[model samples]
Target chain A: MVAKIYRKCGDIDTKEMLFLPYLRYNQSMRETLLHYSFDDSSSSLSASGAWTLDEVERLRTLLEGYDKKLRTHSPETLYLDLSQVTRFDTAGLILLRDYIRDWQQRGITVELLGMSEKMRKLYVLIADAPQAKIVLRYENFLAEIGKATLRTLQDAYAYVQFLGELTVHLLRLLLKPWHLRLKESVYHMKQAGIGALPVIALTAFLTGMVIAYQGAVQLAKFGADIFIVDIVGISIVREMGPMLTAIVIAGRSGSSYTAEIGAMKLTEEISAMRTMGFDPFRFLVIPRIVALIVVLPLLIFFADMVGILGGMMAAKWELGISWHLFVQRLYEVLALKHYLLGLLKGPFFAFIIATVGAFRGFLVEEKTESIGLQTTASVVNAIFLVIALDALFSVIYTEWGL
Target chain B: MSRNVIEVENVVTRLGGRMIHEGVSLHVQEGEIYAILGASGSGKTVLLKEMIMLLQPLSGTIRILGDDLRTIGYKEASALRRSWGVLFQFGALFTSLTVAENIALPLKEFSDADATLRDEIVLSKLQMVGLKPEVASLYPSELSGGMIKRAALARALAMDPKLLFLDEPTSGLDPVGARRFDALIEKLRDTLGVTVVMITHDIETIRGIVDRMAILAEKRTVAEGSLQNVLQSKHAFVKAFFKDINV
Candidate 1:
């Protein structure tokens, strides 16, 4: 049936034969056609068509063909005749605008002639319309530097304010210990701390093993195999254990915090909480920060023990060092200050990660894109702060001769 | 008489264990404004989605522009889709794109027009929708409710579609804005000679704009015809829907 219909409607002549009388009776019918001619001194283009979307492709091709020919002649003036255009729409108007603008840009004087009243109204509506222009201004090097410095200073100021607010909340919670939501804090601890244990342990163990294996190879060359214990024991206790754990938690939990709070903000649930006479800091931020601060040191302590055990295994396998000797050397060389220094940084790292994540979350705008951007910024900021604070702690520990 | 631009026959659609439409059927003639009216949760939006081919009915035959939807191939369906445009309830403009870019999207995808022609078309479309060209640079978030609706209408009309579908075009507008939008729809129908299918419960729109209407009730279309024909309907739900309105 479709094939029969297609065969009957195959040609323009056949369609016109069947429908011309009806179209003529319709009285408002517009025939689709294009006629153009160019003289040696000037050019004239005439279009007679139902200039709508249905004829857009054909009109575009016809106009482009004429454009090529007109350019070759380099005519001083061009006349566009639209008197025969019985019907016109946006598509047709736009094509006409493009043609006139192109000719004007080529320094050719173009005249639009004889448009129907309706077509003229549409043409005037679009042709005389005001469009917004975007202008880009170039900046000097010093100006760019000044802008960057100002932006950085603003960000620092905002971060300092966030830290001050968080500290105030923490102090208030400490003063009124009963105000802490213990159940909510424990739920967050299970999510951000206990749920993270396996991956953290695995990564820490592998890091310690890699260090021991690599150190054993070099220590054996100098008959300094026993010193491998000092390298693994001191580094794991003083730096690697706490720093690695913090980095893992930042990637795992920091992004979650940003996404959760950002979604809540988007849905206006955060505002609802505020309207209900609940302080968002006391209800939301306090629980997350307190849970992270309490659980991070315990996680680091667990990582320290597991990482040293992994180092001992690697040392025994590669250096022929007995487990008893490795343990003895670890106990002999590792001091109380090394463990204390590493564990001391855990709470600060947790505070920074939780604060940055929550801050970025609250900063999210209403758009869905803002959530993704804030989540990415949360992870990056948390990890960077953790590393920077770790370095600062190292400098302080060294200066104090611990 | 104009041919049926859209013919939906005995469509049965079930979504998520709930029967949305059962054996519901309606036909919209060419160059006519057809409105679908229903109470809340009456599956009017779902039926519109089915008509637009965005959602498939469990069982039905939908013939659009004389082509049976199920028999058409994917390419043919896409080409058919280009022949029509849909305006969603909340604008549904691409959040990341500026108004001009959003309007230019369908043209850029379907037409081989040059960049300058496309931009000109964007400006023309904005003008046609009664928006200033300066609005072309604004994002959807920057637009007020009425401006967003106008921008979405511009985007829908970008390709000069022969058929236009609107879902609640005047729901969130002031009375003056709603009247203006109704006038715009009437002007578009007169100027473009296009068929329009709208889903709305706005009494003023029903009285002023729609040429025909269908009332969905009890998981099916209960009454369909001119506003007067529907008002004369003896169906309980249909009568209840128009009881409070001074139509």
Candidate 2:
């Protein structure tokens, strides 16, 4: 227990300072190592020196030793003499509190003495602090599996609901064309379409060259090198051009859409727009979707031309097939249905990328890092769905005997 | 006489090809709450950043804890940095870490204190900042606006800083929360003997807690002193700033 003494120094002492005895280190040494001594006659443990963070390790070792000594002896009362403590901090207070608590719990009376006013205030602050029970959520394997399954189901349901809402809004905008954000739509077109031209052209050209080079080698072995034109033109127009373009756009545009919209959501811009009676889907989502849908087919058409051109170049270089012959053969054999079908898949792929991107954007939570997470998920989900749809198209084409 | 803990003399700052502070100067004495006040674009935050060494002034001498910022080496700079703590406007807590971990991060990096000691320190800091123990296990995202600021303050005080820097400490808090925050800052300064330098626009906070202040205007410090000392200034910007807020 502390004595209520007022010192005429500039410091003000509060009533809580009485919770522990106060001492000022006017005559004490400027610095001392934290050490404890047992006064055998008085049966009291007296500690001296500066008890602070820098001396925390020595204090811990001494306390552990003291705990062992006390348990073996089982003293009726424990006298803690902190009179010689020159300085103290929260770390020192914590260690002392824990040591006293353990002894008191062992049915021994612990009497704290010689606490400085600063230390007592700190001690009371720590002692009276509400113990917040930390709740750690732990689930067994089966419970984790069940929770994951439920989360997946909820996410699927949300995605489907989002799709339905987007469809209704799209139909409404179609009926009233004046409501469309044409300027934003055009801006996105320039970003996702025109900006992507160089990369798409490069990848498609490389894919066609690879296909033609491989086909020419194989056809030359069978003495049917002329058939390389059919292989290059058919594969590039029917599959490679559209597939390559879709994959590239999904990585570039889809991720950007998710990041942009997710940031806007994080900053509460979307909430601000909604409060003003503007649908976020109409203002933010639809323009991106419309831009992708309009430009994807155009990108695919351009990819097809570049891909065939690359294949013609590869054919001429590898198999000595003249450009005239290759073009002439492509015109005769590359069916209109193949090109039209590849172009048709563009809109569907664009829809998948744009919807998934925008949907994931809306999923961003209040945390700053969630934008990165949603963007990554958007790109991954768009690519996966595009591939799945392309496989379904392949199955339909085979079933219909196309 | 109390010593000057931080002294900024004729600091000249330019950012992005624009001059921000032409010649700003001020001094923060030991064991006092000093405020930096300015208009919206008057570069109060920039000046705070400069003092914290996040931004270096184009030409100036910033002496903190007896070391010149312009001449301090990397090793000395880090050692000096550990002696002070900064509480940013938006809390700036790591989103991935729990409140406990955020508070303990500096201790973990700087000291060999064991896990039990670290946990105790974290709990003590939480209590000191008037935060409940349960809040420690929660992430930064789970916290309310006031709780976020308190949690951030706990983390800032984790190192037992000799000086504290706060940027718009009460900007987002309600009036009551702002007042409580002001009281907390005063109590912490009294108990810890730490000098505080803060940038705040809250007139209530300035009137209630600030011991001395400097008003920044016209790309430089136009007024400096206690509230009454600066109130006598004839500067137009200073007059406009405190016109509505009667002491």
Candidate 3:
């Protein structure tokens, strides 16, 4: 509906039309009653209108113009006349309060004059009400550093406690294998291990091919191209196969674990299980951890085979080394100790991924957003810990003169 | 008597081969507090959603505020939407934004008010819904069940809508809170002249606030009138519904 600005000109009604369809003004037939006149000598402004939401736009514009004038004139006192306001709503009350506040902030004393009883009550309700205060305290650089240090220490403490509980649960399950849900463990095995096989094989194969191609380029310069087989075999069996498989699983199965259990946490399903006399760790965490531990070694062995096959194919293609010759050279240089070293890290990697994923899941609160946050944290923490553990193992093996 | 603000005629809706609503028709007048009541699986929410245009009826016409929803263009449909507000069952406040920002969203998007004016409107809307200005800074997750409902109500009223739609406004609230909410709705209707369409099964709300009601049964609106009229309905399901509520 169109907004009509009404002006009362000496007992004659005049209306000015303006298009404001959103206003939906229904009481346009009310007497034309809005007029604001300024008295420069007394520094006073008088308004007469309905002053409701329908006229808020025009009112704001008028008030803004008056405020600018007052700022230039440097008025010490401003009087507001609102007795002629025929109607008022929350919007009108807020506008009046804002104007009073704006003038008061500029060292002008605002005084209300000739307000009706209803207007007086409304003014008191809005203007006299205490304004809400928001206090912001700034922290110094040292305080920020101290806060970061304390948070890190607290997180470390929580991690240790989580590890302690997991160890206890694992030991208890070992003492009673009959209590384990074999069906559930197999289900998780298929998900975490079998479902991840294609990606793991693809990553390991590509890494092996890249290593062989790069090694061939450097070795051919020194007439040492035949040693490409040894480089591919030793690296795949000792490091690349296990590390790549673990990283892939951490991205895939670790995130799924966090999301699933985190959703259950949100629905209070884990609490329900505990209330039913079930150990949540044994029911939820132990099965997942056991399944990954059992399947990861086999997955790493498969990755090693695929990686070797990829290297052999690249070797034959790049250096004219036949598959038979490549196999023979691989056997001569790749020792059982190197292969065993990679296989041995499988359970450790699996333990870290499963525990970290479940730990993050259990950390989820009762909010839907927590599921997404914990899932992201699960993948990132698992991948970082896996790499850190791999570096630790490399340092230990190098110091042992292997 | 006022003109009808909502007129749904012979609406038929199906979901997954199940007929949720069949030939259901109802109308709500202006400045009315109309309630839609139904038992479980009786399509109360489905009908509400259809009226809001979230879901389309298979065959029907919904006329809201003189606009036939089926034939309206996107601009016209949005303009019509701006004339009304909806409150979902769970107070579906955006979790990422604080209370004040959520209330300011419609104003910021639709109106060209400055930041200071927007802030004043937000505070006034909060106060209109009986919420303190301090509650504006808190996130939805930090609010209690009742506080969330109030905050959602404040957001719904931000645009000064002529029609307000509420879905189970008192479902999760305590009895005292629910009564206070019903009183607040009644007060808003009286003060703002807003027409309200609510879907609920709360007997207290039906008795205290609703001016008229529709009972969905037998895949249609079997009864539509004042609470007393619906309670006096001869239909078996309507009788059982009110009897089940001990009303």
Candidate 3 Cα misplacement greater than 4 A, ranges: A1-35, A39-59, A70-93, A100-149, B244-247
Segments of candidate 2 deviating more than 4 angstroms: A1-32, A39-50, A70-79, A83-87, A130-135, A138-141, B243-247
- Tens-place lDDT per residue, model 2, B66-185, is 999999999999989988999999999999889998999999988768887888889889988998888989999999999999999999999889999999999999999999999999
Best by DockQ: 2
Model 3, span A105-156: residue lDDT tens: 8788888888876566556545644444422245999999999899668766
Shift in Å, residue B78, candidate 1: 1.9
Which consecutive 10 residues in model 1 chain A have the weakest lDDT in total? A12-21
Q: Which candidate should be chosen as best, given TM-score against the real structure?
A: 2
User: Each predicted complex: what DockQ?
Assistant: 0.31, 0.38, 0.24
lDDT per residue (tens digit) for residues A263-374 in model 1: 9998899999999998888888889998999999999999999999899999999998999999899889999889988999999999999998898888888665889988
TM value for model 3? 0.86
Ranking by TM-score: 2, 3, 1
lDDT per residue, candidate 3, B1-247, as tens digits? Answer: 7799999999999999999989999999999999998888999999999888899999998899989878989999888888788999989998877898898898888765666666777877777688888888888889999999999999998877889999999999999999999999997887667899999989899989999999999899999999777878889988787775544
Each prediction's whole-model lDDT (CA): 0.85, 0.86, 0.83
- TM for candidate 1 is 0.86
